[model samples]
Target: MMSEWLVYPALGVIAGIFAGLLGVGGGVVIVPILLFVFTTQGFPAHHMMQMALATSLGSIVFTSIASFMTHHRHGAVRWDIVMGISPGILIGSFSGTWLAAQLSTRALKIFFACFLYYVASTMLRNFKPKPSRQLPGPLGMNGVGVVIGVISSLVGIGGGSLSVPFMMLCNVPVHHAIGTSAAIGFPIAVAGTLGYVVNGLSIADLPTPHLGYLYIPALFGIALFSFFSAPFGAKLSHKTPVVTLKRIFAVFLMIIATRILWGAL
Candidate 1:
């Protein structure tokens, strides 16, 4: 029990660093680790994935705030873009979580694993969008937000892996895209968390230390360290070759995705 206490916070530190460094919400890190921890801790098999997803979103609420503030200090975040897409994100995030509650646990695991692999491949290629069109109007941005929010909520991610690429496609600069994505995570986390909580309330068998589907202990442990470490990652991003780091992180994502797929099968 003591080891788990230490380990969860340590995971938060790692998740925070990665969130800041990559503009990812750390859900990519949090979900898999929680899957392992909950399974080992003898949590009910049926509800473990739901709990993990809920907790991942909960931590992202804090992690995104920390990361976004840090990026805002550097003037990287695009508040205009955030405003344009936020409404769609809020709607889509809640919708996606509701949909996830309808799916089987195995199906959700497979879906998330597949999504991770796609994100990993995109990062590995470092694909840059050609300046094919000017930045979209509000409607188009909202559409993009809907997709990002839906997919992110389903997979327990912050939507950066999808949003950064979409923003680049709209001719936004990479750094600004990353920063804006960090800001976007907040709406996704908030809406998704609420949806999960509501969904869990209808289920009678959730374990203790939970607020709805969210595991309170894990949320506290992860969010606390994540909040502190996010700034460190934000600082390092400027000094580091972020492209290289992103690719390395992508490789790590692929490895984790493979492990998840194996387990799901």
Candidate 2:
């Protein structure tokens, strides 16, 4: 328990470092870390994944704020995209949490592992879809948001993996895509957090210092550092040479995903 104080903040630092730079790392890092810690600490096997997902989202609520605000200052965020997609994001994120709460832990782990693998491969290849058209109409944006929001809730991600690609496909620039994805993460986290909290309220014997699926101690630890560090990452995104670093991160995600898949299966 005491050691958790030291290590949980480390998770925050990692999350904050990547949140703005990649627009997606908060959940990618935090969910698996929390899942492992909770499993070792004798948290309910059946509920641990949901707890991890919820807590990660809660942390992202803060991290994404710092990240997107920084990106906005750099003139990288796409406000039109954020506004057009938010309605659907809210609906899909909330509903997806209900679906996640109903899923078995094994099912969730398998899905999340696969998603990680996909993200890794995409990052490794530096894949960006060729622009086919301009930004979509409101209805189209809403529909796209639904898919991204649903997947983000289920996988406990910031939706950058999905949204960034989609944005690039629609001719949005890379920095803008990443920044808009950060902005998009906020609503997804908010709706997903609420859904997980509401869904988990009736469950018994959860760990203390919890709000529904959120483990407050971990949330506090993560948020504290992530808030301060996220701006740094956002700044770096505007200036850093990240090709080599991105490859390294991609390989890291690959390793983590493979390990998770092994455990899940």
Candidate 3:
């Protein structure tokens, strides 16, 4: 138990660096680790997935703040896009959190596993935006934002996977889209974490050191390590070959998703 508590901070550091470098939600790394760690700690199997998902969202709140600030400082964020998508993200996050709470742990794990495979496949396809001559109007932007919000909220992602592609299709530069996506993560994390916490309030048998849906030790540890590590990851992103990184990340996701799916069955 004592050692498990110490591992949370280390998990945060690793997840934060990945989030910064890949612009992912951090759940990809956090969820698996939490599932393994919590299970080893003798938490009930029925509650393990729920706790993992909830704790992942809670930890994202901190990493998102750090990543968003870093991107904003670089002047890459598009405030207009962030504003346009916030309302939809807030609503979707709440709904998704509620939905997740209603599902069985096995079901949730299965869903997550499948979703991860989809993300990996999409990345491997090297999907690129079709050339567009015109910029998207307000209505078009709002529609895209809504879709991104709903999907991201449900999957515990930061919306980059969807938003970046949509922005590229709409004529936004890749760098700007990535930066804006990072900024958008802040609102998504905030709303999603709050929703998970509120929805989990009725779960009477959560493990020790937990508040609502969140594990305090995990949150504190992840926050402490990820905050500083995120900046470092962001720095590395600029130097690394993006194409190579993408392939590596895709492969990593594929392996994890396969393992998770097999475990669920």
Query: Which structure among the candidates has the greatest lDDT?
Result: 2
lDDT ranking, high to low:
2, 1, 3
RMSD in Å for candidate 1, one decimal?
1.7
lDDT of 3 by residue, 1-265 (tens): 6797689988988988887776666877888888888888888787777678777777777777767776788888889878877777777666777787788888888888888887787767777787484456666656666666556655666777777777777787887888888787777777777877887788888887787777778878877788888878778989988667877898998898888889888
Q: Is candidate 1 or candidate 2 better by lDDT?
A: 2
TM-score order, best first, reads 2, 1, 3
Candidate 1: tens digits of C-alpha lDDT, residues 169-196: 7788888988898899999999999999
- lDDT score of residue 205 within candidate 3: 88
Model 1 ranges off by over 4 Å? 238-244
Worst 10 contiguous positions by lDDT, candidate 3: 133-142
Judging by TM-score against the true structure, name the best candidate: 2
What C-alpha lDDT do the candidate models reach, one value each? 0.87, 0.88, 0.77
On the 0 to 100 scale, the lDDT of residue 148 in model 1 is: 85
At residue 192, candidate 1 shows an lDDT of 94
